[model samples]
Structures are given as structure tokens and as C-alpha cells.
Target: MAPVSALSRLPTGAKLFITLSIALLLLALIAIGATLQTGRLADSEVRARLRIAANESARNIAIELSGDINALRVAVAALRGDPADAPSCARAQGVFAQQATIGTRFSIVDRSGRLLCGVPLDTRIPDDRDDPVDVRILNHRGLIVTVAAPGGAPIARVVFPTAFLARLVGSGSRAMPLGTALIDEDHSLELTSIPGQGPLERTETVQTDLGLGGLQLRTSIRSAPITSPFLVALLLPLLMWAAAAGLSWFIVDRLLIRPLRLLRASVAAYTPGEVIDPGKLGPLPAQEIRELGDTFRAISRTVALHEAGLADAVVRQTKLTREVHHRVKNNLQVISSLINFHARGAPSADATAAYASIQRRVDALAVVHRNHFAEMEENRGLNLRSVIGELASNIRATAPEGAGSLHIALDVDPFLVNQDVAVAVAFLVTETIELAMTCDPAAQIRVAVKPGDEEKRAKLRVVSRAFVESETLTHLLSTRYGRVMEGLSRQLRTPLHHDPMTGAYEIAFPVMGRD
Candidate 1:
């Protein structure tokens, strides 16, 4: 059988855990992707809203600053009417005050850095600058716009309060939470403070043509609220997925895997001739599992019934076989008695010897049947040592009167042969011993059954002077005895070997046991 792998040996729970873990990992990846996509959408939406707010704030700042610049230009034109004398500060201030809105102030200075006109007598003119129109931010006076002539000399300066610019930038209602700031791009200065206080997450800038120097508006927003919704969206599904996976594992383990494990255990413990009991498993969680267990129990019961029937049939056959062998053995004994009775009445010695020979052969067969019957329970085969030994003893006891002093020696090894082989071995031994006694009345017959050259084989050898090529033995071979021995050897499936020099008759036969 092939060996099972380590992975295959793992329990159902461990395999389920691995499967669930892989699913959870995929779900985690999906959650992360969803969270990233949600954050991108929020950022895009916030960016769009911030862009609109910044654009709107920049436009308002630009429009307010444009009006202030145009008013200053009108004041400058009014002053340019007289070129001979410097415009009177009182007259210039009067023209600017009429056009200027509340919280607005103006200062007019000549090419020599002397104050030419002012709304207030103590109004300070800003330093000379090059741009025709420039905007600056002051901490106390909001935005300052300086107008200079084509000669690169400042002609006038307008001061717009920071409160007025803040009002212009804060004109409209916002769709989202945000902060706004008006910046002087030239100086990198903030004209108005951003609306909200703490650190901002997103910021956008919009440039405006204020007819002065560089000026722009910045809009910013915090993303804490957006982040809260994104986290909820990402976590909600993941939690649900985990719960569902856990529930699935629990259901499968209880309803399917656990009941199957129990059924497997019961099957492993099953033995032949015993009916399997599905009720040992108690109540199963699933109907399918219950049905499977019941099916297995039914199959096991059917097999057990068949096995019982086969066992009973085998017992009956064994009894019948043994009875047949017993009857045959009894009949052989009766025939031996009849032969004894007939030989007792024979008048000639030759006839008496013939009867003795027939009795010996009959006894040999009887011995084989007895041994075979004895070993039938195991069917291992008859013991060669016992068969040959008993045969040798019987031949010596029934020796002719003159050959009564015959010395027959038995040296046999313990080996087993089937009934057929045992019969052949017995007959061969009986013939050789009888021939030896007939040729030499006092012959020392040596019978040996020993391990053969090949495995599971044994050599039955009869060593005596009768096997030699003597005239008496040759004359005896002309009778039916020599042919009978040959026939027995053939039955054993091996040629009988006679060594003239050693005076031994040998033939090999198969044995049940190893050498």
C-alpha cells in the first residue's frame, strides 16, 4: 500500500481552519481595497469642493480690490488736471473720500517723496515702488494698494481695512466645512486669517487678477469626518464576513465533519461475523450523515450473515470428510482380517508369503489414511517420519518365519507430505524392505527419509544388499514387486534410483515443511 501524505493525515478541523484562513485573507485584501477606493472618492470630492470655494473667494477678493483700485485711479486723474503745482492734500483727500467706502483711507505722495494729499492729516504714505498697481497686506490696515506713475514713482496709496476684505471673501454660504484665506502672492503674505483654527488636511489655491500685484485665495478643510465614514465602510463588511465564516465552520464541524469522523471510527473497529451497530453513534446532526451510517450498518449486517452461513457450511463439509476417511480405514482393516484368514488356510508357503505381502501393502495404505485424517483439521499434510517409521515396524513384525531375525533400522527426519505423497512413500518403503528380506533373510535394512537437494522436498532411501544387481535380486525384479515399486515411484513424480555400489534405493518426494 502507498503511504499517506502528512497533509492528508491532518484532521478535518485543521483543514477547515486553513480554508477559512485563506478566505479571511482574501476578504482582508478586499476590505483594504475598498477602504482605499473610499478614501480616494472622499479626497476627490473634498478637492472639488475646496476648488470651488477657493475660486469663489478669489473672485470676490478680486472684485472688491478692483473697485478699490478703480476709485484710486479716479482720484489720481482728478489730481493730474494741474501739472504746474503739486495737488493740494486737502483737495485730493476730498476727491478720494467721496469715492472710497467705509474703513477705506488714501495717501497721495509726489515724485520727491513728499506727501501730496491724505484723508487724514497724519496719514503715512508708503515707500516708492515700480509697479503701476501693487497690493500689500498690513497687520492693522488690511490690504494696501500703491499706484505709481509711468515714471516709476508712487502717486497714491489706498488702505483697505482687513475687516472689509474678510467680509467680501465670506459672502456666500459653503456646501462643506472649509477655511478661507486671501493671500498677497507677491509678498507671500496672508491678507485675511483662515477661518478655522487647527491643522488642516487639504488646501487649494486660486489666483486672481486684482489689478494690483499677485494676489490669491486659499481654501482648506479637515478630513476627520470623512475618515470616520471610510473606516465604517471598510470594517462593517469585514466583521460580517468573519462572523459568517466562523458560523460556517461551526456548522460543518458539528453537522458533517464530526459525525463522519465518528462513522469512520466505527468502521475501523468492525470485524467479520459481527453486525455493525449504528445506534452506537447516537443522534447525528444531519439527516444525510444519519442515512450514511444506517447504510453502512445494513451492509455490515448482510456481510456478517453471509459469513455465518459460510462458517456453518465449512463445518458440515469437514465432518463429512472425516467420516468418509474413518469408514475407509475401517473397511481396510476388515480386508486385512480377511487376507489373514485366507492366508491361514493356504497350503503352500508361496501363497502364505503372498498373503503377507498383500497385508503389508494394505497396512501401508491404512497408515496413510490415518495420518491424513489426523492432519485434516490443519490440512498441513501427513508427517513422513511417523508414516515411514510405522510402516517399517509393521514390515519387520510380519517378516517371513525364516526372515524373522531381519534387522530393520529407521532414520527418518520430521517432514510433512500430503495424503497422496504419503501413500506413495509408504508403499515404496514397504516394497524395498520386503525385497531386502526375501533376498537375504538376515539383511539389515536401513530406511532413511531426509531433506532433498531442493527446498520442500525429501529423499526416501532404503539401503540394503537386496538393491544390488545380484542374481536373486534380479530374479525378484522379474516379478510384479519390481514393477509395483516403479509404479509407486512414478506416483511420487520422481524416478527411483538404485545405486549398485552402495546397495541403496532412493527417490525424492515433495514435503510440506521447509528443509
Candidate 2:
């Protein structure tokens, strides 16, 4: 892949668009995840409610059938306890026959288990108690459910969820089947739809003994599954994602991308030297793009003014060059005349000393004039080579060389310095070299010119090799030379590096860029 920085340099609008698109995609993914989790939770909750409802229905049916059978068993016992031919016994049988459906039918058996009177009086039931259950079940019960059958008096058996309950069982497609059975004192099918068996059944015998043989209660179990009802179950997350994408597009269009496009257009038309009046554009509110437009306008105004001022300054500088040249001619003539007067008169050694002293001052003044004249001729600055070489030549001739020859060399990127800086350097070099020569004439002194290393961070070095060995010179460098060098470095927007190793002084400063 290309470097991220290379791609970043593409227009800001493109960057913003890509970023916005990515943000929207991430938002969509998050929404979908949240939705799915919510749907799962919702499903669980709904299923729990359904399960509870199903259990309630099943339990209610069991209780109703059991209660009815209990009532009938009490009535039958009252009739049997009376005389066998008694009108009450016959009346009880008549009442039973009137209410007899297969669900309510019952048989009264003698102590030998022989049928006495009722529907299925001659029929036999399956011996499920002796038959092993094929599938194991989690719960078990004997005959009665929610209550016990009265011990041995009158046996009653009942099945729950008659056809009537099934008719009202469900609301639309959510219906589930639930059935149950209970036995009481009256041994009969107290609540049942018909005589045949249903496809699904759960039968359990309550282990507690009844007054008669064991009785069974059969029930069907059904439940709804559980899960979360709010987020994913409703598909709400998809709607939110679609809405967020629309918002992202709207935001990028009105607030971010369009302004950047306008800025790009303005930058395309910009050029350095040519005059432009961005003022033709009107003022705007202080948003970033508007502020940028205002900055461009100000920059155009400043650049135009600068170009005109530079052209005018060029012509004025040409005129000043000629005037400086005339002044230099006058100063040289005066110095020449003074030297001639001194030569014509021969006095004592003291007199000669005084004359030489006067000549030295004149030479100093002449160096100053030469530098000024050079600056004027250049129009904008002083030539570095000319100024340095001239100063070095002057120092070799007059600065009381004690015991040695002086070596001076200079190097650079072949450039010039500002007039003021160049003149100061020229004077500084001359004074420093003179000070060195006065110390020891026999000393091997070297001044070399070389380009500064860009990686070195220091610009230039004016090295005086032997002077650094002197404690006095070290003090002068620290207190005086250091301050002067630092001031000049600041003015030039650079740094000076000074290293004094034994007798050597290597001073380096940051280089000014060549014009």
C-alpha cells in the first residue's frame, strides 16, 4: 500500500469523504450487533411469558375436573349407604344416567371387581400400571392431581381440558395443546372430550393408595421458548443504520467537503511574484474556510506592495553606489597627502613612531571606507570574498607582526552577506588577527576558508589556533567574543559553536543561505 502521508496530501475533501464513509460503515455494524443481541433477549422474555400461560391453563383444567368428580362421589356414597331398593339409590342412578357422556361415565364394581351398573360396566381398561413406560418423564403422580382421592369410599376418575376448553384454547396461530387427568372418590371419567386416546399424552400414577385399586392421571406438556424482545427482534437496527448513512452524506456535503474544494481552486491560481487582489472577493463569517480566504487576501495585498517597494529601492541603490565611489576618492587623496607630508620631514625616532601611529589610524579609517564603498556598489549587500580578503591584506601589512607569519583562509558557498554584517566581520577579523600577530611573530598561524557542513548545525568558524592557549584570550572569548558572536548569530537567525582545544579556537556558526 502507498504510505499514509502520500495519500493524506490528496485534497482534504477526499480525505473527509473517505473518513466519513468509514465512520458510517462502523456505525452500521455496531447497530446490527446491538440489534441482534436485543432480538435474542426479546425472544427469551416472550417465550417465558408463553410458558407461564401454558402451565396455568393446564393446571386450571386439572382442578376443575377433580372438583366435579369429588362432588359426584359424595352423592353416590350417600345413595349406596341407604337401603338397596330405597328410592334415593334409584334417584341417584337416574341422575347419573342423565349426565352420562363418555367423560362422565362410571362403573360401580363389587368387592370381587365385577361390574355392577354404568357405561363400561362390562368393559376392561388397559393395565398400564403393569406396562413399563417406554419414555422416562421428569414428574410423576397417582390418580388425583392438585388433591388426593378420598381413601376407598367412592372412586372418581377424571380427564381434563374437555372439548369446550379446546374451542377457546388459542389466539390465532399461537395455540398449543395442554391436557391433564385427575381421579377422585368417584371412579369415573369426570372431564373428557371422548373415549379415544389423543396422539400426545403424559400419564402418571399418584403412589398414595386410593380406597380401590390404583388410578392414573394423564397430561400433555407444552411450552413456548424464551429470548429479548426489543432490538434485533423488531429489525429496528437496520432502520437506524440507513438513517445514519443519510446524515453522514448530508454533513459532508454542506459543512466539510465543499469548502475544501473552494480552497483548492484558490490555491491553484496562486503564483509568487505576480500581483493579485483577492479583495475582489467579499468578507465572510469567521469559519475556518472563510478565515483562510481572508488570510489569502491579506497575503496578496502584502506581496503586491513588497514588489513595488523592491523595484524603487533598486534604482535608489544605484545612485548611492556612485556617490560612495566619489567619497572614497576624496578620503584616499587626503590619506595620500598626509603620508607625503610625513615622508618629507625627517625627525627623531620618537617623531617617526608618532608618524607611523598616525599612518595606522589612517589605514583603519581607509578600511572602513572601502567596506562602505563595496556595499554601495553591490546595491543590496557586500561581497564576502572582497571584504574578508581586503581586511586580511591590511592586517598582514600593519598589525605589528611580532615573531611569525600569518596564514588566513576563508571558504563559503560563494555568497555575500548583508552590508552591515559584512562590515562588522571585516573589522572583527582585522582586530583579532592583529591581536594574534602581536603575541608571537614566529607563531605558525593559519586561517582557512571552508564551507560549513550542513549536518554540523554551526554556520561558520573563525579559528585562531594559538590564542586559545592563553588564559587571557580564553577570558576575552568567554566575556566579550562570546557576547558579540551570539548577537550576530541571532541577527542572522543561526547559532555559533565554539571549541577551544589547548591553543586552538574553532568557532562555528550556522550558515546564511546563499542568494
Candidate 3:
């Protein structure tokens, strides 16, 4: 393999290297992005899974709790129906328990929030938060425990900080309605390994001195699915580029470069356009090389037959070169036109803006094509600095005097990009320059594309050294409206972010071309 810095200097090698590098970089970036996204998704999925587990566990516990409480209720009702026990000042006590093998402890609270009943010795809890309850315990901890009471006012609070209870319950505490914790409610924390978060909302109650009573029921779930499709979207092209580069390099180097070098060097002794002798050269190693040598020899004989054919040859080559370039330009224009058509048809402002950004990138390639003359073998790896500077100049030329003075400074190497990506970045620079200038009449824009941490990573930065105040910028950066910034992000395949203090809007997009 060649050093990266050296690859850009070779004729066809540079373009190939650049194309591969970009593809690899994009693949790396996408892989990284996908990995990151997947990691996040997996974490979220784990959380959701845990939450579901917790909820299911809690729901089962709730059912068991209801059964235990109901059994106690039946006992109380049976005793009460006896009339003598019904009016007794006994304040009936019953234990809450479950039949599942998973460990569980039960506790009961009276109408006045007093602890009444059978329970494990370990737990120490308030029978009721509303009126004041008491509890008598022996062993406190067990698996799959539950606490419930018939009287609604007296809430049940279960505290499981013990090692045994902690092991039994994966994570998360179960709370009953009208529960009290010496503190405020209405708080949210994103923790892994906890679920239920079911249809529960927070409602506060003013209890006479029993601290603050609040019921925090499971509300709507805030969990998101773990797939980041955008990261995948950015990766597909990178793989194609990699496969293309690998195959092209093998073919071009063996078939075109090396053999041609041997032919030109060996045939140098003969006159320019002379009738070459095939046997004069050694037997070619490969069939293709031998065939090319023979073809060159035949060409020499033909050239010798008609010396005047050289003029016609030059004319034909020139015509073909011009035709090829023209067709490429027209092809680029068609792509740009298509992008524009889609952009105009976009239904929302954000969608339109995204399409507009896409069109701009296409336009940039179109500009490059416009500047390239016929006969230029490859426009890949075109100087980014020159293109950027020109793009900035173009924005200034089209805008007002104050905006037109905007200067662009580029600090990036002449990395390779295909006509497609190059055009897009060009438009990005143009759009950034124009927008930045418009934002602040005296703004100076600095656009830089630099290699990032890994080979598949690149950073395209457009920053303005200007002062403009707009609340819309904050809205643009908001998570609620992040999708609205389609233009900047679509071009970069990254994200658009704005820092309030510096008033800098940075859009980092992934480009399929690399170092």
C-alpha cells in the first residue's frame, strides 16, 4: 500500500486511492455510527425489556397482593358479619402473602394507616401515610413480595434496600397509590433494568401533617426503538465505493499501468510513431500484455503507412474528449434538475430545506463540470480549496454588497471526491457562505474539511465569525425541530447543531469520499 499523502500525486492512482479512502472512511463512519446507534438502541431495548419485566413482575405481585389483601378482607368481613366481632375495638390484623415460589412479604394498613397483619420480619414500613400506621416485623426480606390494603386512604410503602430483597427483585421499587416519601413527586429518571412505567400520571394530595402524599403511577413510556436507519442510510454507498475501488485498482494496475509502462519504455528506442517490431521485445508475461504489445505493433505499422493520419487522430481524440465532457456535464445537469424538482415538491418547510440542500450539492458538481474542459482525464480529487473559494466568491457575487464582501478561508487537503459528492460539498460551502453572510453583513466564513479520529471519519465545518441574533436558531437546534434541518444534515449525513453562546451553527455530515 502507498502512503496516503503520496497516493494523491499519481495520475489515475490518486483518484482511485481517494475514492477508496472515502469509501472506507464512510464505511468506517457508518459502521461506527451504526455501532453507536445500535449500542444506544440495545441499551434502550435492554431498558425497555427490563421495564417490561419489572412491570410484568409488578403486575403479578399486584395480583398476588390483591389475593392476600382479599383473603384478609374476607377474614375481616367474616369476623365483622359475626356482629360481636364487627363492633369490637380489635382493629383486625391479617397477613398478606403469595403462593408463587418467588419470595414475597405481605403487610397490611388500617383506615388510619396503621400496620396490621402477617409479614416477613425484615421489612420496616409505615402502614399508612395518610393517617399514621404502625408495623411489627420479624424477618424483613423475601422474593416476589407485595403490600396492599383495602382502606384507600392508608397507603402502603415498601422499602427493599436489603441485600436479600435486592437480589429477588431485579431493580425498581413498587409504589401504591396515595403513598408518601418525605419528599416531592413529579420527577423522571432514565434508568436501565426497570419497567412498567405503565399508564401512570402524578397527582399530588395535601395530607394534614403526614408529610406530602403523592401517587406516582406509571405514565406513558418514554422508551424509543433501538434502530438508527439514518446511520444505515449513510453506509450503503461506502460499501459500494470500497468494492469498486478494490476491483478497479487490481484491474487498472495490472492491465493498464504496468504493461503500458513496459511497452512505452521498451518501444522508446524506435522513432516516434514508428513501425514497431514485436519480436524485438521479450515474450510478454501475460496474455493481455502480449496482446497489447501486438496491437501497438500493428498501430505502428498503420502509422508508418499514413504519417498524415496523426493530424486526423488528434482531431478525433479532441472531438471525443469534448463530447465526453459535454455529456458528463449534461448528465450532472439532469441530476441537479431532478433534485430541484424533488425539492420543490417537498411538503413541509423542513423537507423543502433538506431538498434544497441536496440541490445545492448537486449544483456544486454542476459548477465543477462547467469549469472542467474536455480532455481532462479525471475530475476526481479536484482541489477543494479552489472550489470552496470559488463557491464563496460566487455567493458573494450574487448577493448584496454587504453580503458580497464575505470571504471564505479553507484549510483542507485536496482530497478526492467523485463529481457527485464534490458538487454537493461545493453547494454546502456556497449555501453556508451565503447564509452566514446574510445572517451578518460583516461575517467572515471559514469552511474546513478535516480527517477525524478514524479513517472513515471526516469533519466538514462551516463557521461564521459574525453576530446575529435570532430565536429561530435555537428552534433549529431544538430536539423537537431537529428534523427540520434537512438541508444541512442531508448534505453531511450528520447533524446540524448550534451553540447559543458563540452563535455558531455547525453541520457535520458524512461524505463518502475520504482522506
TM-score against native, each model? 0.66, 0.43, 0.30
Assess candidate 1 and give its TM-score to the true structure: 0.66
Q: Give candidate 3 misplaced runs (Cα > 4 Å).
A: 1-321, 324-366, 371-375, 378-380, 401-407, 465-469, 472-488, 505-515
Ranking of predictions according to lDDT: 1, 3, 2
Can you write out model 2's per-residue Cα lDDT over 16-124, one digit (the tens) per residue? 5567666766777787777667655655664555455445544554344444455445544653463242453355356545334423344443334533334333223
Cα shift from native, residue 304, model 1 (Å)? 4.5
lDDT of each: 0.75, 0.48, 0.51
Error of 1 at 65 (Å): 12
The better-scoring model by TM-score among 1 and 2 is: 1
In model 2, the Cα lDDT at residue 315 comes to 76
RMSD value for candidate 2: 12.9
lDDT of 3 by residue, 3-99 (tens): 7657656777557667777767766676667766765665565455445544554454344434544454554444333433432213333232222
Candidate with top lDDT is 1
